[model samples]
Target: MISTHLRLSALSLAMLAATPFAHAQTQTPRQSGDGAYLLETVEVQSSADASRDGLSQPFAGGQVAEGGQVGILGTQAVMDTPYSFTSYTELLIEDQQAASVGEILLNDPAVRVARGFGNYQQVYIVRGLPVFSDDMTYNGLYGLLPRQYLSSSFIERVQVFRGANTFLKGAAPGGSGLGGAVNVVPKRAPNDPMTQLTVGGQTGGHGHAAADIARRTDDGRFGIRLNAARRSGDMAIEGESSALSMAHIGVDYRGDALRVSADLGYQDHRVDGGQPNITIDGGVPIPDAPDATKSIGQSWTYSDSEDLFGTLRAEYDFASNVTGWAAFGARTSDESSIFANPTVTNVNGDYTASRFDTAREDTVVTGETGVRVRFDTGGIDHTVSLSGSVYDLESKNAYAFGAPAFSGNIYSPAPVALAPNTVPGGNLSDPGRTIHTYFQSVALADQLKMLDERLLVTLGVRYQRLKDYNYDYNTGNRDTNFSYDEDALTPTVGILYKLTPTVSMYANYIEGLQKGARAGNTAANVGQTLDPYETKQSELGVKYDGGRLGGSVAVYRSRKPVAGQDANNIFKIVDHQKNTGLELMAYGQITPTMTVLGGISFLDADVDGDKAIGAPETQANVNLEYRVPQWQDVTFDGRVIYTSSQYADAGNQQKVDAWTRLDLGARYLVPLANGTLLTLRGRVENVTGEDYWASSGGYPNAGYLTVGAPRTLLLSATFDF
Candidate 1:
């Protein structure tokens, strides 16, 4: 283990090493304004390269070296590291009145959402890569990695980092990191006292209530925040309903000399998983079709989750003009899911009954710590960071008496309907049927600046260790354990030339890796783990600053999976997947009162693999918002999205065709008699009501799930006290 003192010493030495090159890079321009040095700023020079604001506050040593603006926990940090990334702000989410994280991501052209359990649970696809649950990162570190089947009422925003990230983060314990990672940034303590309450209902008879409370010291030195929400409603689909509750609390301290913070949360949820939705007679992909209409009436299931989490952060400024920051967090989650299968109609069409029950319990615990330091070297800058983490999980599933009647055809919608007189379900919690797993990882990185601040280079390495244990279901016997250990060295290099004070063109090369484990396998593949997977991405892009308008465009090529399963089900890491694409994003004010933010992503991710199963070959988005200058407080927002055709099933039997949709919304602010400001907002989603497919369909199950939330009208009013 590396001590904190050693970590600090190493940062100092790294800076000294970078000093020689610092003098060679030319100096960039600087801005002057209030607290300018403390506001981290980033500017994309091109699609693949970026430049950092020189006036930003100094960063800690040992932090993963970065390029452009680094977004962690909602705060922006300026770095010149080489990577393509994007950030969504809380204002953006609020403006969209997004009901869930999935809803918010619909506007991002680079992200592809995969439907799981209807639209309640989903995963993201990036640049032709599969970013599963375990591949999640928060504040630049690993957070919850379980398959999350929950809402996003409390999250503030999300950060999406594309391409290979082997050195920035460690390895994926589940061995499922085919794409990149998404970091969720929860709401932080507020800087002012506030209390907000909301009550709303949806078109589907779903209603919700939410409350938020926050307080902060005047100097921004200390703050506390609390959030709670509850909802109960019938789902958009027939015979589906849900109930959920969640709460969060956090405390934070930030000062010129030192900083510390902590956070905690818990949630309880129950939902009707509703029968698998499917279409019949080759009709539109509508819910309540023949399968759902015929199969044993829709089944009902419930899941409960109890979670506790906390994090501590400390920072110190040394006399050497260098600063060091360390952060550590721990989280634990206990979850249980109960499934009920009921007989809707007997073979003779007589209404008879049978019920089968199964339950699964999963427990996860994790701990992580990271430290970094930074200081000026002669006339250049240097930064370095080190981090380590440990994670453990245990899952158990039990089947109750009479292997619940698996007799109904999922295609028969009427046969499976079970909303009324739902068969009584039991929690088959099996203490004997379980799987235990453990993982540990360590990472170190260094970055240097030189050539009058025109060029920067970064190098990083990570080590991973994993162990798994399983218990037999039938015999109630334990199986031999599994263990794997591996290490990887990743390098990132880029160059940025100051073409002008407001424009720069740059390019970069970065590498990342993923590892997988072997479990629940046959004798032929038992005790087998696939080789570590690696991906390398190369990008060339440019960014320009037009004072009020900022935009960037990049062209990139990403390699395919390093190893994977073939038609015979054998595992290998050498089967690399490949994707080449172009992306463009623009943000800022187009006119005095008109602000526009939009982006487009075009890609061909299927060079060696099945084209139907990967990301769409092309996608685009455009959003416009304008605040009326005459009215001063009225705003209008609108957007349109489009994507190319993609595969509809794993077997590639059917292909999903290209599609598009449009949305419009508006907000008005007015003064009230009590000195409080009243805000009114409304939105008409799917203005065109164009039906489209957001994801591919599973074979056996043909036809993609349709997009377009019908025509939804949302009206809300807010009063601030």
Candidate 2:
């Protein structure tokens, strides 16, 4: 039904098409250097803050971007792209006072944040597909950033790419993000020097302080940017406290024909008295959601993690129409935690929990190289690109859990001291090697533009290989060596036709790859490593750009293989999942003083023999900002997030009712003495303090629920020097 309507809209646009012979002065929609590009026309703009590369341009809405990276194909204007994506700029991040990755994701309607399996890691669900934090890329390089928690201060932009991206980014070593990907762009030095200091506080006495400084050489040939922040205080939820610190430094050099950049960072985070997830047993009916502020986690339990990482990149132009680039990155992380998670036993909110301790260490190295060339053949413009990338990750982990179960209640939490463990996992203090994963891929693509560049077609394919290994816990000995030396070819096709200067129709077919698993020690075919499986997605969409207003409609269908155990208890990849969805999105300035941004997704998800778990049927979000016409120095903003009922059990027996949340915010800018500017911002989230289970079942073969955060009030002030 959605496709039929989309065709009608495209047909209407086609009927009003004009001649293709239009102005050649407009900038090209395509990009190079993996979405990083040189400046466009230097025409002066009226805005005080204007970026030549469009990284900070907020279309008409002043909240989201008009274009972003399309994986290996580089960046493209939103109207010309065949895929669905949204880029959130730094201006919006700071205005919302978002401190973590999870907080930043609240602006997207297509994305929902959930908790990782039995841990504090944040998980993002897009189009009913789960993408773990480990799959997030930093400046297009994987495994170089922190795996669990990352401060928003380290990032300049958040680009959300929805749909399968195997041909663009290659197979993720973590074997997640099959449906989508999030690429974080690091902060860069601005042409003008900037130094700013900020201070903030939240509902539960949480305090925050951060400083940002950036400077470019007199000739603007060399630049440096630095960011440092600290956060410590009680969280919105009762009894919970948080401590976090981070430091980041970046440097870059620009020459006539070459460019180089590097980034280094460190982060330390800890949490105490934080609320945890609850696992639901099959036989018992699911319990009602408890109060949002109730926390059962022991006061003595805590979680801590630290990470150190760096990356280097270079891009050089060999000819007027040719460019080459390379990049490399590495990360070392250490973490230890002692926490307790509860599990529901009955419908009356009865539950039980235990304390578990663990330690982990990780070393990762990732890099990529590529080349691009542009030419013309008899009036037809052609762009060809070739690239190769690799990711290697090794994890050393150990854990101990020997304490007896402690009784608890979901409605009324009872935090009790746990008996010390009698038996501890070998050397939990110094974890041993546990897992090693490696991935590599090579991709080639060609874009053909004909009919005065009104029609664009792109074809590409990637050859990918994966190798995963597992070792015995505490001991460095290899237990199951899953040496999958096999490789797969994933192809992609995309087409875009410009019916007019402001309207376009596009379609894309792409494939996704996931690492196949090996037989466990108890399986009949133990140690048998299987070849990687593939998933496919086909999408059709149309976009319209009205200068100050924009919108898009997309319909897609995808199928992916699911891993499970057979009746004989043998592990294997046997079944497939089919997902069909319709998405409608809108953004930009609806008027001179008011702007709107939002989208809605309707999904139909089904497994081979059962219903898909954890995914809701309908999800939507809307954000609005209006400037006070009378009080020109003040602005008002509001946002609402809604999710329909979702199944928490595979059989679809337990379900959650649809819920909606409202957030309100305001900002005032004042001109101070000495040409200085001061800004005051305040926000209230979850104004009603609603009690609900926000999400469920991120991990495979289990249905666990995570509670929503309590009502929160945030206030902050910034001084520009």
Candidate 3:
């Protein structure tokens, strides 16, 4: 089945590529008034082009975009939309030498990075809620990118949407994303021919190399791009090593009435002797962090994954003011890992760990189709959109546990003999199906413009159906008692008013939907499935765009239902967690030679009249770049990240210390006589070499500590021909 899908995707790419050339060849030269032959002008536009509905143009400093996609509503300028969003540009990705999407997101103050439970997968914390890495979307399609990690070489833009968004996109398959959503746009061929190569290395003898090549047809209607990169060797942490290889191909076509794009990508990543998360016992105090450069994981432990994914999208203009679009994407991924996360029993850091091995395979297929129309009614302008989407996933998994727990100290390490596997589930070599999920949704939205287009009002709703099935791990038999089938409706309302040419005021009320929890076997109503849970949010903000500088100030409040067993031993939705926050962001050129991008977040999270675990009160970031006046080719950049102290447990009995980090970088550009350019970049992260816990928890109600990276150096050189 996977091979058949791949063949169909390849055939579609071939047909799309052949159509533009054939159309170009059929055109003939025209005779001008002077009886001279002249070629017709061809207007070309790629997915990278900046427009109202396409990718937004970079702001004054070239680090962030002026706006980004607002779900089914397409793209809208930041000031014209009620929600808060930030689009990081490819320039920023290159300048920072970011290796993954998580690294690129470090500049966002509203976000923090954590690790998956007992594994190496990256997890993002937004507005006191978790958004799993697998939940992120690519080009507005879900479950198409690598699950554990994402390579940055083929990414063009990373867009962050704040607040509940089920009405805009759909219910996330991972059952998260109540706080925010993330969407990544893939790279596309530009207007000009290009060939570039880059080589770099970091601390601990790591080496890297990458290549990017692009070209377009003579008529400028067809374009293709290819990107590949590899990295290998030891990491900054002691005794830790990793290897990563990735490749991507992109093809696109642009015409007067139609536009199409296709992309395919592959990635293989492995990590050995990587540091593991720490879990403390309930009565034990949170221990002090160990050396930043040290690793606590066993040398025999490792994690690895391989992924293949692709997407195809097309857009057509039915008329000057009406449009329709569709997109399809699929992914197949395999992962295997051996983990030994420690549980500290005392303040002395003495811990016990046992080996746990697991394997998983995931296959995902998702697609969406929509149409939009523009018309006038009684002197008011209206833009109406209708969209439908579907997603399906099949997951196979197996696991084994070793006998006899090993002992170790956080400050001192000891090696122990490998233990024998005493318990197992399914076959590790050939796992059977364990979970199946299916989701379908239909959405409709209409935007009304009044008062000479100064006031905008948006009304939207989505009806979603969710189905999940679980199977016995050992026997591969269906478990009807643990299955669920449910449906729900999510709605949104937003209003924006332009006070002036440079300022705007906006407000919105939105909801996020998630699958309800099934009663546990110990509960009175075992196996009973409740209705879908709805997370509600309300926000108000003001935006300022001064051509060279842009900023926004917003305040929002959200409530998420919590399910648990009541006093009567009946499982039900009993309580809620309420989160309120204020965000202030500033970006763009502060002066002709200086650029700044950063923000601060203040959050108040409460559940059952206590502070929520891992939710900090204050988080802030400030990044600055300055160009040397004496040498126009020289640039210096620096950043400061600060996080306030937070509790490690729900009871607020254990607290993690506050921490700060500094990073510095410099780059120089050289121009050659042959029209080629060379760029050299050098950076130092964690310059102070501070030892601290970067984050406390990622999974719900579980506080696991992830150590911060040590001081590391990165150097790179790029040549363009």
Candidate 4:
């Protein structure tokens, strides 16, 4: 029998001991108009409005640090936005040592993690919704896909808008705007000649480096930014490790009327990791042995991937209240993998294949142009924006294997075959194909104000057309041919009433839809692109702001008027779903020396009016930091996260119990004689080392499991020049 009480690892012990002595620094405060000082630190809860230069501006929950708002990409403001939204800045990203968007989102209670094809990719589940960025829009145009295996090293900030804002973005269905969209703002010109270098070592001899240099004019008009990171080491878990390199360069010009920016970046990762699944005997969850072995049918594999992407954007303001812009972007990825199946067992009680190989190649290109016009109408300000774009994608997936099954069972251990080769006469190149999708959108919006600007009303409508074409493929020889044409007209409305200069309440109703060709029944009872997916969402929330603290709370419900579903009761292409949630978040400086960002969320998702499988009912995050004046420049941070129990399978028989985790981190700032600053930080994850499952079994009657990352420690240092 496995012991339920797991001891903390050596790494965890080190972090726990050092955390109490770390230095904490208070953030600089910038004044807001209403007798308030905005803490310039992190972007947590704030009005997400793109019109505001796309940078984080402190409002509710926490300070929207300027650096955390707009980067090389774009901006999303919470208040200026029509839906539920949040964002994180580069400083926050650095503090958490998050490697990708997926890592960052795990801190958000409302967001969930979807399976990733590779460690470098992102598979975010927001409010039970999946986010995919289609139409490569790097600087405002086309971007790359996750399968291309990109990293966040070059990203300056990340923004997310929950619910539908399709009116603001065309072809919202194909992009991250589905439940919401994530915009990675790139880095721009720095005002001063600045340079930074970071070096770190974690468990398993892991080492990492990050370097950045920037220069900008005092007037905040022109600048250049360059950043890069390289990491290599064995991962905390045995059989899991890798090496990676990434770089990003950007040049920008910004003024009262004109702004232009361009960014070029690339990332490559050589990985050797497998899915970590747990085995449960009876009602007790199994634990990994000291030698690092997991459940059967599990995977232990190695993968390598390289990604490249770049973007160019130009914007001009024709008038004081009007502006227009054009942008273009290109991205590509090459991924290859080899792996062994650990969980599989044959009828004769033998293991599965020794190894197999797979590869994916994908590319995306995008172009776009848009204009924003603002005018006064009857004492109210009205803003209207219109945009259009064209995007193309080429994706190829192929596999070759050399192994034999021990028996009829696919999961059974099998010995190597005499030769490793593609199946005889297999169409190895058949997966190579091109997909071209064209999208156009036009939006008209107006904001009406009354009662001395205390009462606000906003209304807008958008018309969109989407066309997907399968080009450059031999139709007769193709195993999969995808083509589609669809259009949608979405509407958005919102109202806000200011109880006072420091408090306000707002409500919004919006609509979302996804249209494309459908694939089901495999030609037997196939259905033509079913009616476009329709999601109607409504939210009511309030904002509160004081001199030193601010935050917001909201409850929302989004329903798909009609959906497709299967009998198993899980959400799939045919499964219909309804999701509702309540969210509360707060962030700010409780005092000159204390900063906090935290939130809690309760969610309910039903498929066909029944509880959706794997949809947890509650989740929360609480991150607190204190900067003591005595320790000047030192900070101590602690985070508490909790997730309620949820079903693991469609039948609900397999369930993942509720779990909570504690993490402690700290940073110390040391000043060098040359005015250079050295920042040292360390973190302990999963202080309790809780053994929990993340995912359940898939397909057939066989069982599978997903395990949470075990306790690990990381230490790093950064030098500023």
- lDDT of each residue in 1-721, candidate 1, tens digit only: 1112122121122222221110111222222352111112222111100111211211121111112224211133322435666555545665576766556666677877664422234566677665654456544445453355435665654666766665566555554444566766556554335566666665467777777676666444566768888888775445556777888776666554565556666666666654332222232222221322112334445445555555555555553444455555555655554444322232232222233344556666666665556667787676666767777766666554333244444333344433322332333544444667676777766666777766665556667665656677555567653544455555566655546656667777766665554532643465676555567788887766566676678788877554445566665543545788888877667786677766888887563456636468888878888766666567788888787777644445445667677889998766545434456778877777554555553221233353324555666665544
Residue 228 CA displacement from its true place in model 3, Å: 0.3
TM-score of 1: 0.77
Q: Can you give the lDDT of residue 620 in candidate 3? A: 96
* Candidate 3's TM-score: 0.93
Give the C-alpha miss distance for residue 243 in model 4, angstroms.
1.5
Best by TM-score: 3
Instruction: Give the lowest summed-lDDT range of ten residues in model 3.
Output: 1-10
Candidate 3 structure quality by residue, lDDT tens digits, 1-721? 0011112121122112211121122223343574323444433332532112556667877788888888899988898998999999878888889999999888999988888889998888888888889999998888989988899999888998888999998999988889899899887776556678999999999999999888778766777989999999999998789999999998887777788889999999999989999998897888899887888988888999999999998888899899999999999999998888899999999999999999999999999999999999998999999999999999999999998999999878666777877688877788889999999999999999999999999999999999989998899999998787999999999999999999999999999999999898999999998899999999999999999999999999999998889999899998898999999999999997899999999999898988788888899999999977666567899999999988889889999999999999998876544645677899999999999999989888889999999999999998866
Provide the global lDDT of candidate 4 against the true structure.
0.59
TM-score of each: 0.77, 0.91, 0.93, 0.81
> Could you tell me which 10 consecutive residues in candidate 2 have the lowest summed lDDT?
14-23
Q: Rate the local accuracy (lDDT) of all candidates.
A: 0.54, 0.79, 0.86, 0.59
Task: Compute the lDDT for candidate 3.
Answer: 0.86
Candidates ranked by TM-score: 3, 2, 4, 1
Q: Between prediction 2 and prediction 4, which has the larger TM-score?
A: 2
Model 4, total clashes: 55
